[model samples]
Target: MSKLAVGLMSGTSLDGIDAALVSIDEDKKMTLIDFETLPIDHEMKAKLKDAMDIGASSNELLCSLNFELGYLFSQAVKLVCEKSHTKLSQLDFIASHGQTIFHIPDGKFKSTMQLGEPAVIAYETGVPVVSNFRSMDMAAGGQGAPLVPYFDYVNYLSDETICLLNIGGISNVTIIPKNASIDDLVAFDTGPGNMIINGLMEAFYDLPYDKDGQIAALGQVNLELLEELLSDEYIHRSPPKSTGREKYGGFFVEDLIKKSKLPKEDLIATLTKFTALAIVCNIKAFGVSKIIANGGGVYNKTLMKYISESFDGQVEIGEYPDAKEAMAFALLGYETLHKRTSNVPSATGARKHVIQGSITYPS
Candidate 1:
């Protein structure tokens, strides 16, 4: 029998909360029942941005936001269930990725933090909650990121070289070559995704994002700036690595604006191209036969055009583009619920496979 569960993901892009109600069987097949992109109030958005900046945020603020986000997450949980006309009793569990505050995936101090207290969610909803999905892999000496590779491998592994790429606030790829084993997986972040472009949009025009490549379509890529941007060392890093808002957020955008001083349209165009090429740089050597892409970035036609023009492999968007990450988290939680180890050791640089997540019971 398939288990019914809800998965929630609030990515680095700060777009909104993605809630997915999905059904998963023991075989790892997922069917989305319903999904919603719940809006985060402007005040909450500003607070989330403040939380991302450790220097500007206080412990009190982080404390408040954690519980506040837990409340918001519970609301989202109810909304998803209600939207699908399914009761809370029908769900086996709630798995939330939570809003990532900061991710330090390197050095002896390697750690990652995500808010939305599981206790609060469980108590509020009267349902069990499983969260903090990255810590176990980190404890096992892994990067604690690019967790989606496990989801991709289970679903897309075959005798074909395929790349499952997700372009969220950051972009990462999972390359499963022909007849690959668990040790053969390759996955890592490809630097900025919608993060930089979204940052530029907000900085220059006070817009949340460039909807559907409209702004980029009107501008031309600045070759000089694009080349300069591509030289960043992260783009040169090997697989089993990951990056987050710290690398591409506020300061990075400010520096780019200062560096190129290009018009807003040109900046968007250049950044979009930068994202496309950075992804191409890493995946070209994999000899990938096809790329199945998801996340907010795939909707940008101009970005897609840039990537399609530069690559030789076939490119396709995922069927459940919007809900893919949410459903993936749901599946990850399902594994933990089963006491199964789901993190891909090769992809995450973990010493070994380990089950991840902290389970909390309702009050």
Candidate 2:
């Protein structure tokens, strides 16, 4: 019998929650039974973005969001269950990529926080929940950011060389060779995906996102600004490196804006193009035969079209058209439930392949 698993993901965009109900067999084959993205309203989005770098003045505010987001996550899970016509008790576990507040990969503050409390999800859903997937990797001297490679390998295990690129708030690529060995895999953040693009929309346009990338497509890409963005050392950095809104944040965009001195629309267009270029550069660096794009960024038509042009058929746009990250997390949750190691030591630079995440049983 196939096991039913729920995977909940809140991306770097803080746009909303993506919940997927996946049925998996012993051999790791997956069938997506149900999937949905519940958009967080303007208030939640504002609160989350504000809390990213700035220190919060109120403990009550932070604590409230912690529980509220948990409820929000549970509701998302409930909605997916209803749509799939599956009950909570029938499911095995929930794998949650919790909301990330801060990701400090280096120094004394070496922990990344994803804070939709798993205990709260367990209490609300009455299902054993597995979450906090990143910290363990960080403890083991890994980036603790790109957790999708395990799932990427499981679904797209191939004989030829391939790269799985996930474009969320940050863009990360995972490399797989002809004969898959754990050590052969390479993955890292290419650069900004939807983070800069969406940040601009919210800052100037007062919108949450660029809706199919229409706003960006209408404007012209400023080559000067694009070149300036590409000049960052992060773009040229070698593999096993990961970045987030921490580096490519509002401040970074403001610098681009100052240098460009152009209309807001033109600035957005430039940043969008910059995102596409960073992705293409990474794909070329990997030298893989096929590049498979996935995540929220794939929904942006303009981004996809530019990516298609940038690669010029050298790399295909998307391997999975819909919610590959969420689907992959579902597979990760399945692996975690079965007591298997779901992390790639090479990808995260972890010393060993230890099982990630802590399980919260319904009590």
Candidate 3:
């Protein structure tokens, strides 16, 4: 049987919501039917940014944004279905990755929180929704991150060591060794992706992103700053690790600006190179055969050029590059519905595989 489902993702970039509708067959093959990205408005983006700050917002505001984001996600689903000419009644289920506000992969608590309310989506769309996909893996003694490795395993398994590099707000790579099974995979975040670059753009250029990295292309990279950034401890960390806004957020950007004496454009150019270098350094250490890049960062020409130049092997863009994460969530939902475990225990550091999300039925 073929099941039609929609996946919604709000990544660490805080840029927008990506919704993708895909058809999955009994054999677990996915065909993306349609997709859309609903950019976050300036006000909402600011609100989300504020919420991400520690001690910046109250519990009440955080509580309200949870449902507010849920409502916004419902609107995204409705608009995507309208544009795709698909009705809610025709869908099997909706899978939402929600908006991640905080992720603490290591600590005494070791918890992660993603805020959009799944019940609101279920109620508004009149469809079953599967969400909060990370907690189960965390409970099973895992990092509860880089969940898309399972998706990569299913779709990109091959006879060569291939790295699926996703550069969203935070960059993570999934390494699939030759003739790799799920247990043979290794994955982890490779420090800041567009997080720092986008932060610099908003602060100095007053833009959302560097846009094809045009700003970076206009300036020279400050080699001194590049070397300084490369020395960050996160870049040297081994696998089975993850990081987010807590490490590379606004405060980090402010600190970087204070430490650098270079011009704005030069600083951005350096940061763009930093992103590329961080990814390349990790890939080389892992001895990856080829790199298949995806996510919003792939669109930044300068960043892509830096990555391609630094990497000696083949570098290619993923199919449906922008919609990869959204589609992954949809595939997770499909797997959950079938009572299948969707998490890669090796990638997430889980003791065992388990169904990853909580299902919410329509009222």
Instruction: Please name the candidate that would achieve the greatest lDDT relative to the true structure.
Output: 3
lDDT of 1 by residue, 1-363 (tens): 899999999999987889999999978899899999889888999999999987888999999999999999999999988899999998899999999999999998789999998899999888899999999999999999889888888888898899988999999999999889877999999988899999888887888888998999999899988888888999988887899999999989888888776788988998999999999888998999899999999999999889899889899999888999999899999999999998988988999999999898887
| Candidate 2 local lDDT, 36-71, one digit each (tens) | 888898888777766775654256666777878898
Instruction: Give the poorly placed runs of model 1, Cα more than 4 Å off.
Output: none
lDDT of each: 0.91, 0.81, 0.93
The TM-score of candidate 2 is 0.94
Q: List the lowest-lDDT window of 10 residues for candidate 1.
A: 255-264
Give me candidate 1's TM-score against the actual structure: 0.98
Residue range 1-363, candidate 3, lDDT tens digits? 899999999998999999999999998899999999888999999889888898697798899999999999998898889999999999999999999999989877779989999999999999999999999999998989989998999999988899999999999999999898889999999999999999999989789999999999998998988998999999998878999999999999999888888999999999999999999998797678799999999999999999999999999999988999999999999999889999988888889999989999998
Lowest-scoring 10 consecutive residues by lDDT in candidate 2? Answer: 312-321
Please list the residue runs of candidate 3 whose C-alpha ends up more than 4 Å from where it truly belongs after superposition: none
lDDT of 3 at 335: 91
TM-score of every prediction relative to native: 0.98, 0.94, 0.99
What's the residue-level lDDT of 44 in candidate 1?
94
